[model samples]
Target: MRAAGFAPTTATYNVLIKAHCSDAAVPIDDAVRLFQNIAKPDVCSYNTVIDGLCRRGRLPEACDLFAEMIANGIAPTVVTYTTVIHWLAREACFDDALKLFDEMSGRGIMPNVVTYSSLIDGLCKGGRAASALELLDRMVRERKLPNTITYSSVIDGLCKEGRLGQAMEILDRMRLQGRKPDAGLFGKLITGLCDSGRALEAANYLDEMILAGIEPNRLTWSLHSKINDAVVKTLCAKGEVSRAFQVYQSMRTRGISTEPKTFHLLVECLSKKNYLEKAAHVVRDMLSERCIPERETWDTIVRAYWSKKKVRQEAEEMWSQLTVTN
Candidate 1:
């Protein structure tokens, strides 16, 4: 257009600046230079450049440009405040982010979900989940609905602090609000409950997670297996062998591999509880999976079977199979 003797207007320059900022191959400095050349920069021009600067980790320059935008008699919009707040939180400057949040509110600018989510995320990461909870409440009161990322950060933070009851409540609230909890969210709560010695509750949540239809992705498949093993092991330790067996069955049906130690514990516990048939079934499964049962586990199953005359032949066959497999 310039070669055709048509000077590019401010609107044309703004479009080019935004395109440059978004393209990784083009340096952000080019966008800044174009922005500087705009004779009459509007709010869009400043917002785009500020966002680009933030994306490049140039927070100080972004802030300075933000102040200059204001000094030029150009009023900053909600996008302006949110961009700065998001970057401030990402950089771990929670205090500065909060101050800006208050400043924006004082200026009668209503914060959107992105703004609240950013601050809540920052607070949660800073070990102030309690404060993040307060922000969540305030956000709801202000009629801004928290999305998955917002709730996830708060729940994870609460779990890390061992405030599991609150975490569960937030999870429930999230569900009621129509947000589907993913495998990672359930995994965090399960891990927290297990660490708190509340294996029974953890086991219940595991069932809920499966019932919720949250499919484990490649990244979370091992997480599901690990937590399932933990709940089964803890249940066995607590003498809840029946429940442990149920969970173990679920794991197998889902094609999740059981650890050798967990398999042994289940087999041993079933034998001790006089469930000789179940013990033998578990032993067969262990062998089929190529998991070598402990010698004590073999002794436990053999003794239980031998004590019952009705299954003495079964016991002898099991010993033969074990000998062959070994």
Candidate 2:
């Protein structure tokens, strides 16, 4: 349009600034150039340039522009406050963020979900989960519903502080508000329990996760593997082969792959205890999962088959083929 001899409006500059800030190839300085060229730049122009500066991690420049906006007597909108507040919170400047929050409120820029979410996350990260929760209450009273990310940040803070029960309570409240807990919430809780050496409790949450149709990601699956591996090792060490097999079957039903050593331990223990039938089943499960047992594991199964049950010819042929392949 400018090339066509049409003078650009403030809205045009806003759009250009937004595009420059969002596109990596276009430097934010271009937006500032356009803003400077504007005969009468508007608040949107300033907001956009400030946002671009923030995105570029030039917060001092952004703050200077913000102060200029105030000096020019342009009322900052919620978007203006939110953009700066979120950036400040993210940079761990909770005190500055709080002051801005209060200042925005004083200006009657009633806080919205994004505004409170940033403040809540900032406070939580600053080891102020209690204050964060209190702010959550204030948010509720204002009829501004907190979203999943908001709840997850607080839950993560609670977990980090080892307040699992309080975290669960908050989760309950979030659910009651008709918001579904996503993977972040479950991951933090389960990870916390596992880190606390409460694998059994982690296992319980794993079950809840399955029931809730929350598919575990690679990290969550790896955590479950550790928990199940721990359970299997403990059971096998106590000579509870039946219980160990039960635990392994549970893992199998869920298609959870644990450490190969855990499977080897179970197979070796079962074979040595003369539970050749169960040991044979274990070997089959491992093969189906494409997890090849170690040589000692195979040898134990081979001995158990020959000594305890000479009638099992399939085991003999399988072990012979395995040996040839090895």
Candidate 3:
């Protein structure tokens, strides 16, 4: 419009304002300049600049602009107030955020779900989980349905804080309310459960994930491998060598391929059980399969035979074979 050498009317300017405000890469200063460049500013133009600044967490700048707009006889709209309030919440300036909310309500600008969710996210991040819970209740009381984004934010926060039980409750509530959890949300839950030593429950979710057509990625399998390896090693250290070998065999039969670290762990477990010959065989197979042994692998092999004087020559020959491939 400006390129056409035609002055934009207030509505046209408002359209430009909205366009510039939502563009993340466009700096607030550029938006302000565009508004100023207009021959006459309208409420929409002012609102757009204010919203852009507030959303970017420039509260003082937004407030200053709001004051200027009022002075210039441009009345603030509901969208204007909400944008500033959301910005305040993002900055964890809850007091200012709430104050603005009250002011907006007094001025007949009714708050909505966007307002509540902003504050809820802030509260959760501030470690005020109880306050966030209360805000969720308030949203319901205000007849605002919590959207998937709102619920997901709370769930993510809970998981990060290790509040898995509470997170699960929220997850159940979300499902009951007909909100399907996305893959990222489900993945977080699985990771949290596994980390908390609830692998049995994690296993159930794996099936649920498959049934829901959520493909498990490499990360999922990586976590599973770690948990299984830890359990197997624990069993082995407690003198359950047979059980440890069973675990290894199960991994092989299930096509759950492991890194060389798994083979190293197995070899260590076998050596501990006085199965040096079996351990040597495991090491040779690992090398024959072209799995690069770590420095620790060679150290383990050498040390396993060091205490027995009779097998020193055999250990040296095995070491030579291991180094040739490297």
Candidate 4:
């Protein structure tokens, strides 16, 4: 352009830099070269360069450019502050991001919804769901209603942290506000319920999703399996062997294949209750399917025999056979 009698201003370079910075598929070196080519760089140029570096995960270089901008008496815009905050958030550096946010405000830069949303997301993602909730309260007190995405993100985080009740409360609030959860948010809720041993509630939620005309995807199916496994394990742990066995059998009728872990857990549970005969039969079934019995399997049977004062010799013989065959 310069050779074609067209002069490129600092703003032109800044625009080019910003464009390159936002393109995830673009190389960072290209943005850096464009910024370097700018002569007599202004605030926009510096902001563009700093944002570009941060976007490329070059935080140190971004900081250096920020410092240089200040040295040159260039005031940063909201976009510049946003770039730094987003970068820090992405790195899980919430403290630094919050400090930068405060500094931006101290410099009289008012944050928009995007800034607040990003900070809230960072806090939630960093496992600070409590803090995120507090921040959301603050936002509400200041008359800023949360968007659906913000609500969903915080709900997902709370659910993942085992605060299923709190997450449900949020979901209820969302519904009252006439906002519905998308598939992803529904998946998270189901997963959280299952993780908390609320398999029945998880199943109910799945039914609710169906009633709402939402089809369960692979993720929902995976959560169903997890919830079923947890229920079976809990039943077994409570010495409800017959119930666990019934649930295991019902899985096949539901088209859910019996996983290896399910067999292991059930066998171990039966053995613990002095049902070595039943445990051995289960082990035989496992081996019949070419699933080699784990050491824990042998140990369970041995302990079962020892518990009943039956025969350590038989236990030893079984152990020897397991070692040779397995």
Candidate 5:
């Protein structure tokens, strides 16, 4: 356009700057040069360049340009404040980020959901979940509905802080607001509950997760297996053999592999309960899955069967069959 004798306007330069900033192969310095050449830079021009600087991890330069924009009688827009606050939060400059947040609010600029979400995420990552929750409350009071990312960050932070009860309340609130919790979110809650020795509650959440139809995808499969294994093992240790067996069945039905320790626990607990037939079936499954049951597990099953007067003959025949199969 310039070669065709048409001078590029500020809008045209702004577009070029944004393009250059977004493309990793293009040097940010080139975008800065183009921005510098804009004769009458507007709010859009400043926002574009500031965002570019932040994206390139040049926060100090971005802040300086921000101040320059304000000093030149060009009022900063919501985008301007949000961009700076987001980067400040990302760089773990929570004090600066919060100061900018208050500054924008004091200037009568209302923050949007993205602004709140960014700050919430940053605060959560910095282990300030309680503070993040306060922001979430204030955000609701200001009538800004929290999105999935907002809720997720708060819940994850709460879980990390071992404030699981609050996390659960947030999850319930999220659901009431019609936001369906994903597997990762549920995994966080379940892991937290399990770590706190609340396996029973964790198992209940796992059931709720399944009932909610949140199937584990490739990304969450490992987490699914891990939580299930933990719940089953803990249940067995707590002598809730019946519940453990139910969970084991659920894992198998879902095609989730049970860990060897979990399988062993189920077999041992079932034998103790004198459920000889079920115990033998689990041992058979162990063999089928190439999970060799420990010798103690075999002894438990054999002893349970032999100790039962009603199933003595069946025990002998079953033992022969198992030995042959193995």
Candidate 6:
């Protein structure tokens, strides 16, 4: 274009420099050379080369270019600071990142959500969750709301540190502010609870989670099933068959499918305890869900119902429906 008498504008030059920085075949040195040859290289020129150098793990060189940019009176933007902060965080160089963030702020570059997010995430990953929480408070004071990743990182750190009560508080606070919990968040809470031997608390949250209209993913569903089964087995073994039946019914209504063995054990226990109709309902529910009870399960249910003369016809009808459905 220059040979054709069309001089490249500064914007055109910036574009060319960015193109060179992005091309792996063209080393960042080429882009730097091009930047130096330009009559005036703007902040974008500095940012492009710094980012390219950071991508290739040339942080020392990138910092040198940053210094040169500052010495040349080209002030760095939030993007400039964020790129370096994020890279430094990922590389486990938190002290330098923090100093750079402070310097950027001193230069009147207000950190954006991306900047705070990087700092918070990096702090949490560096085992400074308390500091991350402090930063989150500062973010709120600055009227900069933390997003999901921000909250999840802190919650995860709390859980890993076994500060579950505090974690639950944060979870509730997020809910009060209308940031609905996702399946991943609930899964983390549930796993943490189970690990702490507070599975019954996990069960309560599972119920609340489904009621809140969040569908559990595959892993969450599996954990939920395990917790519910534990509850049912505990109730049955304690001779609280009525309560156990109620839990069983709740599981069915929630579309939580348990194994045939769970139903069989519950029905057999209920029959021995003279809860004939509840036993019949359990068998009926099993057949409806295509979880066919074994022959012995059927025999116990039928014999228990036959012993109750008045409820015999209803039991026989339920049995007939079960057979036809199966």
- How big is the positional error of residue 326 in model 3, measured in Å on the Cα after superposition? 32
Residue-wise C-alpha lDDT for candidate 2, range 162-242, written one tens digit per residue: 888888789889889999876567768777765665555655665676678876567677766665676677667667767
**Candidate 2 steric clashes:** 0
Candidate 5 regions with alpha-carbon error over 4 angstroms: 268-276, 294-326
lDDT of each: 0.90, 0.82, 0.73, 0.77, 0.90, 0.82
Better of 5 and 6 by TM-score: 5
Question: For candidate 5, lDDT tens digit of each residue in 1-326?
Answer: 97999999998998898899989899899999999999999999999999999999999999999999989999998899999999999999999999999999999999999999999999998999988999999999999999988999999999999999999999999999899988888888888887787878888999999999987688888878987888888778888877888888899899889989788888989999887777888899899999998988888888887788867877778999999999
TM-score of each: 0.83, 0.76, 0.64, 0.64, 0.86, 0.67
Off by over 4 Å in 2: 1-7, 125-127, 216-251, 261-283, 295-326
Question: Which residue pairs in candidate 3 collide?
Answer: none
C-alpha displacement of 183 in model 6, angstroms? 1.5
lDDT of 5 at 205: 94
lDDT of 1 by residue, 56-135 (tens): 98999999999999999999999999999999988988889999999999989999998999889988887889889999
TM-score between candidate 1 and the true structure: 0.83
Q: How close is candidate 3 to the true structure, as a TM-score?
A: 0.64
Q: Which numbered prediction scores highest in TM-score against the true structure? A: 5
Q: Return the lDDT, model 5, position 248.
A: 86
Judge candidate 4 at residue 9 and give its lDDT: 88
